[model samples]
Target: MAQLLRQLERICGDDHVVTHPHALRTYESDGLLQYHVTPRIAVLPGTADEVREVVVACHGAGVPWVARGAGSGLSGGALPVEEGVLIVLTRLHRLLEVDLANQRVVVEPGVTNVAVSHAVAPTHFFPPDPSSQIVCSIGGNVAENSGGAHCFKYGFTTNYVTGLEVVLPDGGVVELGGKAVDLPGYDLVGAFVGSEGTLGVATKIVLRVIPRPEAVRTLVAFFDHTSEAGQTVSDIVGAGLVPGALEMMGRLSIEAAEGAVHAGYPPDAGAALIVELDGSGAECDARFDEVVSLCEQGGATGVRIAADDAERELIWKARKAAFAAIGRISPPARGARADRRALA
Candidate 1:
């Protein structure tokens, strides 16, 4: 431990390398909280060069290192391996470039998922919005191949990732894809996006963006039973109308959310389906009408469409906060095995 610290201190100065137990505790777990392991050392690297140096030092000492983003992941992808170094990349957060004409945004791995959309919101969007977009990092999104409500239409993180600069396990740097598509050989970039941490660490990435839709309408359908809401989702899909997002929440989730954020929903409603349609004004209106009719057929007692921006935000907020709203559903446990347990 002392040797690793000394080596990191030499490479990035002592202040940047954290060996103190108290400070290292934060990196022990991610959002899941089920698994936790304190790393022997945690280093925050500000640049790709600094990260490569740290990886080289770990290689020289014959030690392993785990790359971490915002640690908002639920899969323990950022959980520190026993006796390994945890390389936190939050310090490397930066929006390297935004090419509006080409619809591409280059960002460091540590940049937040929401930051990408926030950067393009005034014009269009980056669209792969996980519930944790406000806190999760794009690098982690790439690693997890994350999907969210909008993914039913916009697709997953792998769909948006266009280029990546990675540092391989053997400590060699390579650029898999570039600003232009089909840069030559194999589509290595596609393979690495969801390879998690086993493949390598992504230092930088290029994301594809799209123009904002002309109109978007949110329809909230309240059903008397959970299955009714689920069937409504099926009916909506069956009608040949692909909404931007089709999310269903059960009684437990709806109750918890009502308690937390009261999005003007029926506290007694058995279930809720938040369907969103985005596209041309005519298409949105046409599809919106079909969705309402389908929900009614599926036994939805009441249906409401957001009439304005404020109403639309309220509808999405409750859905986005589903994780936190349902926290009371599980008890918090510390220092649990961060990995999956299999039965023999």
Candidate 2:
């Protein structure tokens, strides 16, 4: 162990290697705090080559290792192994390139999900925005196929990822896809994205970006019953109106969120639905009216539509805050886990 530690230190510098008992504890668990295992060592490589060297050293020494991004994943995918190396990728942060002509963006694994959209803002944006986008790293997003709000229209993390530079388990480096679309050979890129880090470690990534919509509208519809909210969602979708986001929240989460962020959710509401629609101004205006009418038909007791971007952002803030808000009210139950099988 000492020999491998020294080798790792030599590869990534003494400052980058974390072996202190207290510091190692920092990598013990990811967002899933219920599970914890203090790693023997942790390393933060500063570049693609450094990452490969660290992985190579671990492979040669027969030590298992885990790759971690921002450690915001709740699925325990970034959980540190008891006796393994925890390779933190945040040091690799870089927006390598942006090509609007090609609609492609190149980034290192450590770039946050929201950063992609910000870098291409006003003209284009990355669409797979998980609730944790602001902090979640693109590498982890690829591993988990994270999806939020616009996922209903733009799809998951896998959809935006066009290419990856991977360091295999045995220290071999390979390119899965490219800036150009529809590459020949096996769809290794597809198999690797959501593998939760089993296939390999992504070093560099190529992402697809889309042009921003001309107009957008957001609304929060309140219903006396969850069934009514559910029916309202059905009505909108059935009417061929594709909402950018159609998130439903029940009384419990709604109350928790209101208590935390005060996002203007009605107190007496049994259920709330956050619906976002985007397109040309005329199209959004035409469809927004129909969506509002359908909410009424579905038995909505009240509805709040975002009057401006500020209001729309607040409405989304409430929805995204629901998970953490609940935690403030009640600590996570022992042996508890998120039911990933549940639909959004």
Candidate 3:
């Protein structure tokens, strides 16, 4: 362990390698919180070349290393392997290119998911928006192949990634796919997208973008039972209507959201449904009516459609914060911080 730490310090500066117990605590677990392990060390590499050097060093020493993004992951993808180094990728973030004509953006793996959309939103948008887009990195999305409300219409991360530059397990760097669609070869990009870091580390990626919609409308419906809301979702899909976002929160989730953010959800409702339709104004209006009718058919007690952008954003914000809201519902255990210390 001492030799590996010395090698990492040599590869990256001593300042970039964290070995102290207090400093390494943050990398012990991801968002899941259930599984935890304090890595022997955490190394933050500032560039792809540095990442390659660190990986090579670890490979040479036969010490396993885990790749990590923003540490906001709900799954155990970023959990440290025993006695391994956690390669934190936050420092490698940089948007390299935005080809508007080709509708593709090339970015280093550590760039945040929302950063890409924010950069392009003025001109267009990247459509695979996970709820954690504001904080999660594109590289983590690639590893998890994450999906969210908007995916029903825009598709998942795999649909947007056209190419990847990777460091294989043996520390060899290679490029898979490219700007051109349907590159002549096996689907390495597809296989690597959702491999959950078991395959290799993504150093860079080419992402697809979509034109910003001219209009967006949000509608919320309250049903007596969750199954009724589910039926409505099925009916909407069965009618061949793809909503921009479709989200359902059960009674507990509704109470949590209302208590936390007050998104105007019906506190007494058994289930709440949030459905957004985005497109040209006329298309959205027509689809909105169809959605409302479907909800009514599925036993919706009441419905409220957002009349402005502010209201729409509030609805989405509540949905985005659902995970945190749910957490507050269950109070942390007594001496939780102390327990975490004991585990460490």
**Every candidate's lDDT:** 0.87, 0.91, 0.89
Worst 10 residues of 3 by lDDT: 177-186
Which residue pairs clash in candidate 2? none
Q: By descending lDDT, how would the candidates be arranged?
A: 2, 3, 1
Query: Against the true structure, candidate 2 has what lDDT?
Result: 0.91
For 1-344, candidate 1 gives per-residue lDDT tens digits of 67878888887778888888989988999986878899989999889888888898898888999999999988888999889999888888899999989999999999999999889878879888899899889889999998899999889999989889998876789987874546667788889988877788899999999999998999899999999998888888877988898898888888888778889888889999999999999999877888899999999989989989999999888888878888766554533323223221
Clashes of each: 1, 0, 0
Best candidate, lDDT: 2
Better of 1 and 3 by TM-score: 3
lDDT measured at residue 211 in model 3 versus the true structure, 0 to 100: 88
Candidate 1 wrong stretches, greater than 4 Å: 179-184, 334-344
Encode model 2's per-residue lDDT on 1-344: one tens digit a residue. 99999999999999999989988878888888889898999999999999999999999999999999999999999998889999999998899999998899999999999999999998999999988888999999999998998999879989988899999999999998883547577888899989999888999999999999999999999999999999888889899999988999999999999999999899779999989899899999988989999998899888899999999999999999988888877955553434333432
The residue-level lDDT of candidate 3 at 64 comes to 92
Q: Name the better of 1 and 3 by lDDT.
A: 3
Q: How accurate is candidate 1 locally (lDDT)?
A: 0.87
TM-scores for all candidates?
0.94, 0.94, 0.95
